[model samples]
Target: MDWSQVNWQPQIGDPHFMGWVTVLVYLGCAILAFKLSLNATHCFKQHIQKQRTFWGVVAFITLLLAINKQLDLQSLLTEIARTLAKEQDWYDKRRKLQRIFVIAVAFTGSTTALLLALYYRKIIMINALALLGICFVIAFVVIRAASFHHMDHLLNQYIAGVRLNWAFELIGLALISANAIRRLNKNTRHRASVD
Candidate 1:
């Protein structure tokens, strides 16, 4: 068990290259989300308040996620947990705190998604609900792997380009991007026709 040999930051494919590539992709998605928010507010006149609020929230969330990915917030939390456990002289408390944090985040995210879905029964909102579902599934898989001491194998598979979580996250981003672009284009065409 040579800890030095363990790749702490195992990413999909080439570790060095893929990490930057994924970060860039996430940044692009965040930019797209911001653009969509702007278009929704300025270009679309109908349902102005609702459209702006929805897109604005989406943009904020996307940007936050992009930043979180870039910063590796989970690792930071892990470090914090380790420090706390060391100070308290409790070995297992780190894992307990980490689990609590994960559960809290998942619960908050799901509740937010459910509220949004109920408020807006549009296709995009439905897609958001689906994205939330995928997130829950991914979390469940990761928790199961960790509980069974199979996380190393799962992470190895992820590094080998079988990253289900990343795939689902990208899919969710794509769905939001597509929906925004479609609405923007439709509004633009309608405006042109009316002019």
Candidate 2:
């Protein structure tokens, strides 16, 4: 496995209909999250720092994930790992390594979610759906990273001409967007009452 033999080109993992739809959904969600962040800033006005921080974090993560949806950064990472395993003559043991990697990722994601929950406990009730949406997207990403053949096949399958992956991705984005709209409305009402 020569290093020169491996192609280092960027690969577009999904370029089809569902892929584009998913990307659009991600972009829409990112915009909503950003709006939520802005609303948090204007509504709190330096009083509730936690609210500002949480929405800001959500906006950042959503924006990054939206970019990643089209760039397919995960595939690049997987390719690098695969190439390294081959070069190191450990390609045969990739399955074990992949399992370990997936487990580590899942643990890290869960831990981060727990920390966020604890830190934002005061607002969790209001943002619970958005949090759940974020979890779904993260779970979808982790499952894709696991790269199991059967899982890939399943995700590729169509139900009523709709890809499973699209459904999973959109559902998460929808939840986040819904939560953002709800918050924005609540904030507007509160401001009106204050005025």
Candidate 3:
């Protein structure tokens, strides 16, 4: 059944809403992380001076990427549906875009990780979590695209792979959160001691 046929007034639960939920989750994580990271800008600037170019670029790009996702994902998703909603080759275009986005995210995320690992010294945990977050973001993008193409009532291998990858990424994010809290407490203790 075409989505148009669904009753709009009463609002039936479209399992397809899960795709939207996943996107929301990705955006939420980005926003929360971005805000927390932004709050540390002064510290990053002062402490990260030795690797200024790399760290500066990473911070800038991370902020830009998060803002872009907040603004761009919805419009892009609509554009995608309009262009490839009924096409048989929809998966091809999606695959191409997914690969491109994955590479971009991986590069940006890895660069951020490198900067923290090199400059911040104490954020080994944050860097590790950010890497995992990048992996999850890639999976999130791929899985959404897969759901879009799954309209043909067909089973695709990549969709399954993405779901499996997403599961592992959850574990990574949990570790990152734990480590971040630990690091925050440690920093707090050191600051108090100095005072």
- Per-model TM-score on C-alpha atoms: 0.67, 0.89, 0.42
Per-model tally of clashing residue pairs:
0, 0, 0
Candidate 3 Cα deviation (angstroms), residue 168: 4.1
Report the error of model 3 at residue 176, Å: 3.6
Write the residue-wise lDDT of candidate 2 on 1-195 in tens digits: 455655556656578877777777777877777777766733435445677677777788788887888788877667777888878889899888878887898899899999999988878888889999999998898789777788889988999988887888889888988988888888888878879
Give the alpha carbon lDDT tens digit for every residue of 73-177 in model 1: 545445454555566688566567556766776787678667776765544442364345335434543353234234535544564565755554566566666
Pick the lDDT winner.
2
**Model 3: residues with Cα > 4 Å off, grouped in runs:** 1-45, 48-126, 146-169
- CA RMSD of all predictions: 6.1, 2.3, 8.2
What would the C-alpha RMSD of candidate 1 be, to one decimal place?
6.1
lDDT tens string, model 3, 52-156? 333233344344434544344434554455455344446546657655765776687568656656665654343455545554544454444344454323422
Off by over 4 Å in 1: 1-15, 41-46, 93-99, 121-152, 158-162
Write down the lDDT that model 1 would get: 0.56
Arrange candidates, best TM-score first: 2, 1, 3
The 10 consecutive residues of candidate 3 with the worst lDDT sum are 6-15
